[model samples]
Target: MSKDTDNSNLTADNSANTTSSPSNDRSANNVAPNEVTFALAQSHFLVGDISANADKMRQLAIQARDQGADVIVFPELALLGYPPQDLLLRPSLSGRIKSALSALSDIQDIVMIVGYPHVDHHGTFNSAAILHNGHQKGFYHKQFLPNYGVFDERRYFDKGRNQVLFDYKGITIGLLICEDLWEKSPIADLKQQGVDIIVSLNASPFETGKQDMRKTMLTQRSREHKVPIVYVNAVGGQDDLVFDGGSIVAQADGSIAHEAPRFLDQLMLATLNVDSNTFNTQEKAPLTLSRESEMYQALVVGLRDYVNHSGFGGVLVGLSGGIDSALTLCIAVDALGADKVYAVMMPYEFTSKISLEDAQAQARRLNVSYTVCPIFDAVEGIRHTLAPLFNKSPADTTEENIQARARGVILMALSNKFGHLVITTGNKSELAVGYSTLYGDMAGGFDVLKDVYKSQVYNLASYRNRLEDTPVIPERVITRPPSAELRPDQKDQDSLPDYEVLDGILTLYIDEDMGYQAIVDKGFDADMVAKTIKMVDNSEYKRRQSPIGTKISQRAFGRERRYPLVNKWSINS
Candidate 1:
């Protein structure tokens, strides 16, 4: 049967409705006689793996039911996975979804609230399926379709117009998808409908300081509506996006009952007292992480999932002994084991002794495979080939770019030969101003710090060093003045502004979306702001070709921020 053919009609097939008896050793009975147990399945569902995702849900449902849960909730789009993108438009989507739902309908006793794509003659929808025993009980289509940064739900789904509420064991439960709870009207309507508890499914991607925002919103909404809330979120990385699973259970009075650990898969359970209309607090809540800790974990999870899901056997990093490469190496080791990571330092004539020492030291400290491949021969050969074309022209940035391209060539060659993923080490500041050489330093499959600024790179390096008894990244690397080592005594500031001033300008212009004059009005030098904006606008083509990386900030370069490659608009205009 089609999953949504009977959207408004809920009926059970007699043969398929056979349910196993409830376990006598029920964990919920020990809590309270008038309470119900909810299991939050915060899991990683790979995109396009409909059958596998359905099997995972079935496993979690049986486990939750055995542990005495009356109901289980999965994150938004659990079956097809969140941000399924163009996969939702595939012709076979309906058949796959139907088969997956049929597999899930076999679970007995407990009700399964699963997120998926609902399709019928009307349209496709971001929806939730209510499954109990062998019946497709009912479904809730997501009301709000977000079309802002990093989201284009409206492109794939038609908006749902009704509130979906159901009763089980004498308690009224209302359902909502990710964007629904963000708007006020949905929850207000639920409150008007007298819903005792609200269960929201989310595939919300992670950004810096996003968890705190979620907590504040949940607290206010639960307290305002006088209804308890159970929020279940997906965990893992999907390309540039990382979904930090910090699922929560908030009481009607705005107190936290349970908070799942961030960036990890968890099957968390909570009990709600029907008499008092409150949830029971757990003995220990997960500790809130510092800013550095949160960003660091998000990066780790992002790279880990991207590499593993992309079917890479391992990763290769072109270590330059600089802060960016140092931190990228550490993250790679943490995400993939030391055994799977390989670090290669491609040095040249101007490569500093300190850089060589630091690069070797970090690789040894991390216990990863390390190699020092000097590019002197390769660079000289390239210069010889280009000498005839130049015909005695004075050398410029072209020579420096040759060295970077040599390193890029070596890394890509190694990756191609060994079936490993090449990780580029350029940071956001470098990418913003075209400081990097395209097909040179930017030739890798992934750039770990593509969204991270130079100042943040230093901060993260220091933060990572503190995690160990002996620093994994060398202290000299962090404290030293940043350089490309492309030429003798070369420093980054020779080409670009100081990172502190540049990042401040970037934060205002890019993240805060401030105009050029408005940024200068905020105590910045007008000349500096103008220069920074010009560089940013000119470098759009480079960023377009750059590899996808982890996005830990509010605005990342790729899908989150888009600009015309040949736009005439500028500060003067």
Candidate 2:
């Protein structure tokens, strides 16, 4: 939280950048009277591609210099992307980062602030440094390490204590990385010190309506401390996390001057004009998106990048003619062209004619590759094999699972042979209570809607189709009740609560972290709450084995949703 004009008061190093220019964007009248502008650089950073990551930043530093940016800030762990996790234990990683910093210093005239982990005599710290021409200007460790939810920063990084302020082109700047801005102390200290502006570098993960929260936090802080703030966030997906990169600028009067696009990589340039006469942000064209649209866009970018970056030529989705798969198909088609997506309609004896018709219709509307892969022969083969073991019982879920597993095998064989990423379409409700099969429906390279609740899946599907010209997802998918089509007369309602009621309780139980008694007290049926809690508790093992999906909510599968698979505690007892 470096505020005020700390850098404006510093002595110049005899460079042309330090000297005042009449054409400068901001006046150099304050204590640190040098004019400075910064660029927020982001990329679709790959996991463990240290050299490539450093190279991208080095190029960006050069580009920023050409664009008149005095200082350039990059995302958290810009050298390795977010949640490098235990890779920090490599020991040589820190040395590579420092060397990268030194190389940047050798290149240009502008200060570059790049985020990386620094190991020193004090301890290991999540750090960002200010560098110009290979010399260190200042370095600050991230103070707050968020341990809750998907973040386990405390396990990897030692807490940063000191706030490092530096002189950049005659202006004082303080740096805070990611979680440091979430707490009060960093900004509060900057306010007390009376610096100019606080520039926060972040790799915050995406969730529904997160951009609104970013605006509110930055604007409120700027108004509270009477200081402007530039928030730069990382973009693209890393495992389950996706960064929206909606880098925003908020002035001291609680007004937003500019915002970057969501879920896409773009350079954001915000020029703030400041002097004793007026402290105003020169307005740039504002980019706007509704909350629903933002969430949808995040999913599309995430799916596209994950599929393409992983070196897959295209994607394959099992179209059950359900909302989840239909929405996933639309997103895939939108992200990669219709040429890159392939929809497989794996209809079975139990699959309704409407479901089959809808699947074919969606494929035609989207104009992607489509084929019907009937599983009757494959399922019958498996059933004949199981018949030898005294199979005298009535056909139950086991028979139904065989059908799903047959479809899964067909998709996976295609995945192995053709190198297409299979996207699972199961929603959060089915995943929450073991409604999905492990090797059957859950088999896939990725799950696009794993975090989306069943109820929201319908809305998102409708919204996505409406966003496009024609209705890609048929009307029957939205209006029809969800069913696994395992048995002749089976529906999802036979095993679980209705999705509207079920998703409501799940949001309370999982996202809100409410206990069983608390959920029951919220006017749900006591018996229903007890049974659902047991199902959720029992399903921990299945969720653990589920494919890592993009986390669109506060608590999604994989990193965020972690429960002991062998737990025996019961809240109702």
Candidate 3:
């Protein structure tokens, strides 16, 4: 942590911003004593699109300059996009990145602080540089490399180790990348150098309640260093991760002067008073959302960015009139719009008339392109072929799985022919217990509801309906018991515990990492707990094969939580 200063030395105000006379020694650093306006570029960047990202940065830089901004700060890895993964290994993108950086120099007048992977003979570093009047002013490499949970910077980037401080106009400003601000040494370095403000560029991914944590951390950093901090974060989804842009500008007193909106791409402006070493942030209150609404927006933003960035014409969701598919469909429509979304109801023999009617009714309600592709013949054809092998035994889950496979095949065929991204609808509950048929309902380019549990699916569906003037999801779909409808009278509860109980047990077992007996100790039936754990344990192989989805929780199926698929350890034993 940086050294702290007494509050009595600071001027505090609740209005727009505050200003205070600098100390005698600090007054020497003020050259001209003029205020500098900084534009925080909380923009979206496509992963690995060097040219596009550069073009966007140039446009934003020009816009910032035209708006009379003295400086503009972009998020970390904004040029090549954040967490480029193995794409960084491509020798081809290096030249493009250098070219893009050169092109960015075309914009003059305003100072630009940009983040990118600085590659050279020394190897790649998570880095940021200050540019002024088409020349590099100062540069800093990130001091910390986060390796845990969704972050693997150690695999791709070498740790950065030096402090970058420069005199801009009259104020001495320092630069820090994402993880650098979270650590102590970097801020301490800047404090010792007597920098007035710290401008941090970040590509921090979103998790439940992550913004609150960021605010607390930024406050701590500001208070410790006795320096104001300008935090700029990227917005948009890159694969499973979504960056919720909540850029902030806070004073040494730990009070925010500006806070940008989350899940949105916009430029936020703040003016730093050179003499006072304080600035007025944008005067809008941060938008607050409930936990459910936050998770819902995460799913929507992740899906929308994934589809648009991938160049998909639209999305295709198999609407089975079940809660999982119903919720998936609603999210797709909301994300990509009804015009871009195509819904198909693949009904088989076991599919009830209510399902048939409800699917069509909901499609009509949402007014998306809806089609019915009966899979009875396709499932029968498969059943006939497998009849010889299964003739010795009574029909089991294999038969039920064939119907799901048939529906999956049809959805995929449409996806292939029409160029629509297929969206899988299975929830975390089904995915956890191996209830989903591999390559059947699991076949899709993306899974919107993959991180969402079954109980949350129902709640999100109800929440979606409330967001609309009229209900998009049929009431019966919400009220009716959930069923796969692959077999006659097939209810999910027939195989698994009621979702209320199943989800609770799962939260403890999977999320909380409780032992078998410990979960049972949480008031669940011992047998159910044992059985559920076994199902979850045995289904690792299936989850490993499932499509990647938006991660709304701290412990999602992919990336966040990793378990060996071939493990034999049993909690019950």
Candidate 4:
């Protein structure tokens, strides 16, 4: 949260004089004489590439100037990328930032509000620099540093004590960063400063229903302040987080003037009328996406960026013909092309004939490189190796786990040999209750559905199938009962609760953070609630070893939810 600092008592370092002289200003600012054209640069910036990021800003600035823009806005920390984590602690961070800012100083005419880290003798600050006419006009340090789930801004940046506002082409624009807009004090203070408009830069990550919440907040803030707002967000995948660029523009009357598409890069423009304090309505605004579409695209962008940025030739998915791997294959083909994707059906003695047929059918439909690598030899070799130690004990889950491990070894071997990443297909339901093996089915560099629940996997499969004339995933894959095919006549429900009941309890306990009694009070059986909670608590070690995936829910298993591997506190207690 930001403090309510007096505008008159603002320090010298925070505010700057950005008004240009009549002789030096460009005609773009004088086009309407009373209006200002803003270019929102909603772009994907690669992390740790300060030099290339700065070059991109320079190029975008020139393009904005050519399109008759008075000012151009980049997302928060566009120079260094978002969630830079410990890279902010690098000794050369200050030097790199300084060099990048110097590189953009030559751009002319258009005002560039670029987000970068400002390292001074005082401390490092998440700041936006206003560059115009070969001079650093002024800079605004982000006042609110969010330190909640997935955000650790306070770990690296100092609190900004002063408010920053400046004038450009008859418009008094107040500057705020991502978290600043979410707070009440920043926008309220800007309103008190007679600011005509608010331009907020963001690196907001994607999650289900996040855009609607943002739009609601924007409408409320703009109406209250009687000021138009321009929002620009960064778009791309960085590790586990996906930034969906759904930049927005809201009029003073609380109506949406423009909205950029989600999960894509966009350079959007809008003109603000100084008299009415509203933007001119464009011919079209992008339609909002359905829940399934949003989640699916987030997965695609997350996987696409991770594989490509990590220098992998392509990706390999173990196609089990179950819904999990079936949905995974469709996503892989969409993210990377059919040529870059390869599917291997690792069938064992227990695997069904229907599974084998459907696996081959889907691969043919998608036109990807598919292989049927029977794991009979691999599993038998492992069993023979361990049989000497066992004194003719009864067969159990141990043997079943061997089948999964055999497949894991084969996939990792192919990945190591060909330099392609192995993408796991485990869903959140199995991951929640520790149903997956540690290094067996979980062996992979990335898990596309790691954050998605099993029920949602079916929804996404149906959504993907509906997009084409012919479904890429076979109908039998979705209709069949899910199984690991590690044991004979296996169905997931044999060991766990039905997905309907299981996801309900899991959503309450994990996502909602409800207690055991509270979840049981929601009509779930008491014993089932206790059992599910115990499994989730006991599986922290497995989740810790799990690969990163796209975050599509309110709370993902990674950084968003942290639990001790061995804790004495019980849900019942």
Clashes per model (N, Cα, C within 3 A): 0, 13, 1, 0
- Candidate 1 has a TM-score of 0.95
- In candidate 3, stretches whose alpha carbon ends up further than 4 angstroms from where it belongs are 1-33, 517-521
Which predicted model would earn the best TM-score? Answer: 4
Task: Evaluate all candidate structures by whole-model CA lDDT and list the values in order.
Answer: 0.89, 0.78, 0.83, 0.88
Between prediction 3 and prediction 4, the one with superior TM-score is 4
Task: Please give the lDDT score at residue 447 for candidate 3.
Answer: 93
Could you give the candidate ranking by lDDT, starting with the highest? 1, 4, 3, 2
lDDT of 4 by residue, 1-573 (tens): 122232211211254333333215564544676777899999999999999999999888899889888789999999999989889999999999998999888898778899999988879999998777677767999999998788899999998877777766556788999899999999999889778789999999999999999999999999988889999999999999999999999998889999999988888889988767779987988977999999999999999999999999999999988889989988998998999999999988888899999999999999999999999998898888889988788999999998888889999999999999999999999999999998899999999999999999999999999999999889988897888877778889999999989999999988999999888889999999999989899999999999999898989999899988777999857
Clashes in predicted model 1:
0
lDDT of 1 by residue, 440-528 (tens): 99999988998899999999999999998999999999988999999899999998889999999999998889999999899999999
Q: What C-alpha lDDT, on a 0 to 100 scale, does residue 239 get in candidate 2?
A: 72
lDDT of 3 by residue, 1-573 (tens): 122243112221111122332222223122233677889999998888888988998899888877767789999989889879999898886788788888877676677888888888767888886766565655677889999888888998877666766665566677888888898888898888778899999998888899889999999889877899999999998899999998999899888888999999989888888768888756568778877788899999999999998999999989887778788877887798999999999988888999889889988987899999998789889888888877668878888888888888998999999999999998999999999999999999899988888988888888888987888888899999998887788888999999999999998987788898888778999888888988998999999999999988777899888998776687846
Residue-level lDDT of model 2, residues 428-523, one tens digit each, is 999998999888889998898888898888878778768767677888888888788777777789888899999989999999999988988899
Flag clash pairs in model 4: none
Q: TM-scores for all candidates?
A: 0.95, 0.92, 0.92, 0.96
Off by over 4 Å in 2: 1-34, 277-285
Least well predicted 10-residue stretch by lDDT in candidate 1 = 12-21
